[model samples]
Target: MAHAESVRVVFVDAETEEEFARTELAPGQLPDSFEYETRLDLGGESWAVVRADPPSAAQFLRSGSLVLTLRRIQTVDPQEMAYSLPTIFDPLPPTEDSTGSGEHFVIHEDDWRQAELVSRQLAGQVEAEMRAIHEVFRQSSRVVGEGASSMRVFDRIHVRRTPIDPLSTEVSLRRLSELLPVGGRPYAGVRIGDDPGRVVDSFVIAADPLVVYGQALGDRVTVLCLAPLLDAATESAAGLEQAMREFDLVLADWCSGRLLDASAVGAFLNQA
Candidate 1:
């Protein structure tokens, strides 16, 4: 597989021309066309990508360096906003069993709403816990106050589904096993569901602080995880150590499924 190249998108204010927000887009995530009215969610605010400087600069957004000028907007169309945002889930290919039975795995709109609610709740809880933990760390002189800004908790989650095969299973297991041991913790692991023999795999993705896991049943796969935006460049040695300790705590809960078990969304998915 070809390596995916990411583009750094810089969002600048239209009025003051000052940079307000920035984010990195994974390869294939950027839209082919940059519409003038395309609205983006930046730090919970809706900002429209008005235009690119020189107009021709828009073409570079997909392949090379990119800059976006955004104007704050009062209201956004739901459909337009949905199109502007990065896709949360990609359609899974039809499996042999699904194709043969003519019964495809369908995700309803309500399912997405439930998932988003769960994600928001989890993010809130995480932020609160981290703040409290940071306070303790500050008092103990383990980390500085600025270290708290190194990690960002996201209010949204990303879900992806793919075909489950022996090759994919082996690859997933191997990757999980290879995760560096943190604080002498056991190697990350996967779980199996007995009801229908679904494989439940969970782990943090390399290069990001995302806690990801999913369940695969009858060839239908659904992976759901929260994306915790990290500013690695801003991390100091003390900050990095503090962040790692925080991550270790969360990863342990995530791998054991206790993290999701405490959420209503988890209950819904479990029953579904």
Candidate 2:
């Protein structure tokens, strides 16, 4: 929890939910304990609003049972706060480091054994997703040009995957390589050919959260910003993977600009 108190909204059904809100009675802070469970219909066939002090719940009844969630207000230290915000300076260093030769996390044999088992499962998923992404580009039309010229800097580089052409892959690859993050990583993968240096980070199966920054050299690095959805993968890794593909197709395309010419948006419906 944050040093400053926060409230969590929750939903409960058919039972009185009890939570512990602190008894300190600070006007804007969270209580140590709380209890707010009652039947107040939210007026839908499946939803209800249950209020309990600072803790509120809105839930839905699915197939005759209430789906309940206790939203938690979490806290982060100063470092996480800084990193999350866009800054003009270099990111702060790691506050803590672990050699792991110490007390916690181990008993070694058990840990490694558990990891090895999970690795086997995830390995298959990684290969399958990569193959699918590659195949989509292989079958689709080649997307041309650097995204938006104004958004890129001389030092910034971009890597793109698009359809392979029968006569000239080199010309397209040359144009695409112009936008990669310079000196950050090499361009490493392409869908259509045996081009060298195609996989930028062969192991960068997912994007790191883009820290919006102005580099020391007076150039800008505008990243595609897929890092947030990448983290979302921990809860549902499959969702993370699917989102990455969809983002490339949807959000990313629109980021280039607009797909339709509009007068007031409705104007385009009767376009010639």
Name the candidate that leads on lDDT: 1
Clashes of each: 0, 26
Once fitted onto the true fold, the runs of candidate 1 whose alpha carbons sit more than 4 angstroms away are 1-4, 53-58, 61-63, 75-272
lDDT of 2 at 18: 44
Question: Residue by residue across 1-272, what tens digits does model 2's lDDT show?
Answer: 22323223335432445442222223243323235433322333333333333332211111111223333333467442311111011121112232223222111111111100011223333244335434434442233347573222111111222211111111122221232222222212211122222212111122222111100111211122121222232222333333323222111121122222112112211120
Best by TM-score: 1
How close is every model to the real structure, measured as TM-score? 0.24, 0.15
CA lDDT of each candidate?
A: 0.37, 0.24
What lDDT tens digits, residue by residue, belong to model 1 across residues 122-238? Answer: 344544443443443344222213665543222223332311121222123233323422222222323221222112232322223222333334333233333223432222223
